[model samples]
Target: MNKLLVLICSGALLSACAGTNIVSLESSVKQLKDLRDHDRDGVIEAREKCDNTVLGASIDNYGCGTRKTLIEPLKVDVKFAHNSYEIPSSAYSQIQRLADFLNKNAELQVLIEGHTSKVGSVELNQRLSKNRAKAVENVLVENFNIATERVSSVGYGFERLADPADTEVAHSTNRRIMAELSHTVSVDDMIWTIYTVDQTQ
Candidate 1:
């Protein structure tokens, strides 16, 4: 009976070890699978693992998932009065469009940058520019109810002139507010489960 008990205990220990080994093996395979199928396409494409086609190819964090593509960043400019931060009636339509766009795209991040024409004291212009940026931010956050975290403001006083020429058109262009967008989509973000194979059978 003692021998029988010892054999039973040994069998249980061996079973536990086997279970641990299987789990460890599965974890290792998962890690490798993440690297290989970042896009999660069942069939591994040559472009996914490594790039040897183009000389001096820039690969992403993952060894696979490479494609030559061009995309334009989203940007919009809002013109302001010479010394005021108030939103003009003419700008209402543009602002409405921008607000609508932001509402539809919840994942987008925006930066509101304000500028001033070279018309006043540097300190005053800086304050005015900052106010203008804040005004736009307020419109988005208060009226449109956009989350504050998704929007930010900054001022560039009399600097970064859109039109460096000393002309009315140039000054008008210089006194403006710009909204820049930032969006990031990783390979994993675009990933989908193509198919699954049952190996248990």
Candidate 2:
């Protein structure tokens, strides 16, 4: 009776260990210890992504997932008044489109910049520039439901010129808003699922 009970307990423990999947970093560390204790740096270690899967995704050595590339920023020229931060009615639909695009790209991040013409005091121009950026930020936040943390606003204050001319066309064109997607991607955010069942054991 004692022998039989011991056998049953051992079987249950084995099954529990076999079915474990470590998804977190700490959990993964323990999982790795349980899996590759005998040969720490062996070929099996290379194949551990299959042994303890976290995201159920295609993974590399570092355990990342499949990547979805987005054409971030979806930029358009948003123009405002010379000294005003108010978004004009004529540009409403255009900004709306950008907001709509931002909604669709939750995984992405952005930087919204406001520009102005070279016809104002530097201090006032800076203020106006910041306000213009804020104006775009408000629209994106209010209408699109995009998280404010995911968006950052800046004011160029006529520092960056598109046309670099004194003409109305140049000034009008410079008075614009631009949003760009973050250039960096988080390497740790991906879910990598590896299928090395044959190699793991």
Candidate 3:
């Protein structure tokens, strides 16, 4: 009889322990679920220092939006000789400055605009302008290691002249290559915006 009584008490203790363990396990699971990312900002609730972040905003590891400055309007003017598309060695420094700027801002892209004087035929000027733009683009891509996809070239020909006067100085000024850089940057406490303008225009 005593043996049977002891066995009944042991069984009860085992059942009670099992019930306690099940409840504890459920509580632990609930706590884990609660610790999951509630805001869905790629950060978990346990480690997230910032809460309620704006959707699609660029963020750091701490779940905080990163600060960024708008890139200023950049214009690089590279002069070309009359009826020539060759980039002069003197222009290398000017082109290098543009390349340095691009290397610093990896997200920015540049547009090379080529222009010509009215001294040549319309078709020839157009082709010459295109070649001039391409020449600058090649130096940026090949010599400076800038990505080709980030640089683009376009020819304006004599359609867009810096000086309309029919003088030697005006013609020299008109025959030029212009580089325009632009990109949108993410700023903290504000929406992503693009603030760069074509200063050459």
Candidate 4:
């Protein structure tokens, strides 16, 4: 009777060991499957902050942005007074944001082109526009500490205007300084990649 009891106990122990082995094997299999998925996807699991990423695209350099390409330069328009070179506080926020971008893209350069309305004479308008552009450039270099070498100022002198009208609203569009980025950006280097993605926006 004692031998029979001992044999039954041994049988129960064998069953438990077999069950544990099966569970361990299952867990290992699951881990392998997860690894396989990560490898097969080929999509980068992590994203970089500086990257202008597109749908299902991964950044090339970790912090510098995506490995893809840009189509056009990022243009920053700095509007101004009719004939004044003063930097307005209202436009400061946009400048501040631009300063941040400039800091990130150290390799980048900009040409700050100034414009004016037809209110002034050709010579006076050209001078005023140049000064206005220089004024903004001064702030960007002095306050933002952007490399002076990376920036150049030009005066179109009423040659280019979104609106060339006699009205104040139209003239306002002409009185502006615009920054054209030296480098082009890929479709991915943008935050909202889609055109009017946010309906409410």
lDDT of 3 by residue, 89-190 (tens): 999998998999899888888889999999979999999999999999999999999999989999999999999999999999999999877656656643
Candidate with top lDDT is 3
Candidate 3 regions with alpha-carbon error over 4 angstroms:
1-71, 182-201
TM-score of every model versus the real structure: 0.54, 0.53, 0.57, 0.58
Can you write out model 4's per-residue Cα lDDT over 17-113, one digit (the tens) per residue?
3323221112222232222223222333353334333444444443343444755446677777767878778988877767777887787777788
- Candidate 4: worst 10 consecutive residues by lDDT? 21-30
Candidates in descending TM-score order: 4, 3, 1, 2
Whole-model alpha-carbon lDDT for candidate 3: 0.82
- The residue-by-residue lDDT of candidate 2 on 102-155, one tens digit each, is 666666666789898988798998899899989888877877777888777999
lDDT of 1 by residue, 72-132 (tens): 3467788888788997878767777777777867877688899999888999989999999
State in Å the error of residue 36, model 4.
6.1
- Model 1, residue 188: distance off in Å is 18
Cα-based lDDT for every prediction? 0.70, 0.68, 0.82, 0.68
